[model samples]
Target: VSFGSELSNRAPTFDMDLSDFMDGDKPISYEKAKEYFSQDPSQKWAAYVAGTVLVLMTELGVQFTDSMSILVSSSVPEGKGVSSSASVEVATMSAIAAVYGLNIAPRDLAILCQKVENHIVGAPCGVMDQMTSACGEANKLLAMVCQPAEVKELVSIPTHIRFWGLDSGIRHSVGGTDYGSVRVGTYMGRKLIKCAASDLISQSFPSTPTQSCDASEEYEKYGVDLLKSEASLQYLCNLPPHRSALPY
Candidate 1:
């Protein structure tokens, strides 16, 4: 029930091949997909799972009755940790909600979308990506409150700061090895913080309807503990920088 553009980048020489899953055992390399119709096994597996979930949700009337649905366009790239996958998922959820004439709150909708991508799709993404994409205001950077779907205006970008994107000659698959592990690490970091400074997340993210047990001042009172909780952040940050996963 989802609609989108062709998966492959079109060229005069040949039509790019597209895979329909993520097969961890024997992933279909990009080279193979580009050269032959045989799909990227890993991506094919993911797509199959995503497609199945979307169908079931749509059937259950989530899209038809939710106000959070709104139509939007996005060009987030996949893999490399740039959050394009979450972007598309949220965008599609927004679209379906729009089609159904639902009126759900934006923040709530963002949380739901994140859950679908992480839990339902079998990925271990953080709430930040989906929340940022959903709450993003054009020309501004969202300083994400990782837990409880809270975000604050970090700063606004120059209106004239035109962003240019460069695609690397190589593209990595979202379901490629280690990608999920990175996401899982980030999630664990948030949970670690949540276990102690629960209030920090609650006050910042009231729209989520969850209360934190610790306040920001209380969290700062135990600054060393906060630092220790975030120690695992390095793993998430150490991923190779690539075009597809850039924050911009």
Candidate 2:
């Protein structure tokens, strides 16, 4: 698919044009967006860039399978710490699964969504957001203990619930410097943790320490939380100047 935008001198204007993939070649150009509309300029530009691929992917699946649920209640709400990006991703994956008539269990769908973030959007995110969004059972907290990738159980928290955020009225360019830095920080933390785990196990033996904790236990006990904290701090340190970033 190819998308382009033309800015008008007097009014807000943008347009999208698309085409099909040839049998043996790539169909889309992964270039960045440069055009702008006057009134809703900045966010519009971001939305155009972000939502173009989102919409294209959503519609293609819906069209192929004639399923309206592919696009059902699917939108990324901005300025909220509630992970609109993950929501959009799960929506896309859910749509694709539905359209293709795939038998996808909830937990498996969550994993698939994580893969999309890791591979498609090039985000080094944890399974938490996508997992919860896709496989969330109402009135419960999903205990996603990270190592062998299993949803252990859900704890109930019954109360009148509310969600809110203090959005600083600041908009961020997600694919810009900050996003890349966060990704790099996350990668670094992951590498460090993996190395630490290996060293720890090697120390247990005369030649090398054998793993006492099962991989699952190590993942749940030390791996996930350690990496998350380290990555968040590293990301904060790496954020760009003049950019106000927040964490969830």
Candidate 3:
């Protein structure tokens, strides 16, 4: 979809039914389109991208007139550990941003895409997939810390070794119950560690200790209460410039 970067202003309009949206009306807001497509098992990723584009646009301060439709056809196999979902998301976002004349850097774009999946798509996935998709080069390894997506460097793939994606033969979804359970358990561990660390600090210190952190730092470190609120979650890594209406 290299053509996405060359797309003209405003998404091309298509006549779509109003009942196919969230409010059951003609104006196709991202939320409405997402909810509509989400009702069908076949259109799950469609819903994901639908929600993603609008939120991205909002974050960038683009004036959305609604009435945008996406047509996707992917060759990436589903139910594999492959970045199929991320491919769609990144492509859709890149396309929409291009059409709207939004100049998003690849790294920042990857972060924005992750926000869409975690917040809008309701998937608790890490940033590797989006980061790799957005910033990776051909025949190079993307090295990074998944601590809220810090890119270290891209290592060159050597001629001595070739990477292969072997099928496990068992179909899996990132949104599946097992995956969700693992994520829940990870966060649970983090919470326990936080409690333990807090206790250690209290026991060790003579004075009351308070961690000095801005909202962004706190969010990246823990993904705690600040990230739980919808408003804050939408702008997880990057706090939106306009926060006058934000509760935090």
Best model per lDDT: 3
Report, for every candidate in turn, its global Cα lDDT versus the true structure.
0.49, 0.47, 0.60
For each candidate, what TM-score against the reference?
0.49, 0.50, 0.68
lDDT of 3 by residue, 73-183 (tens): 567776688987788888888888888788999888888887677655656678889999999999999899777678899999888988878887898777666876676
Cα lDDT of model 1 by residue, 156-189, tens digit: 8987788776777566644455766666456555
Off by over 4 Å in 3: 1-37, 66-69, 206-248
lDDT ranking of the models: 3, 1, 2
lDDT tens digits, residues 113-179, model 2? 6554543343445667777787777778888764445788888876877545566756553445676
lDDT of 3: 0.60
TM-score of 2: 0.50
Residue clash pairs of candidate 3: 18-25, 22-32
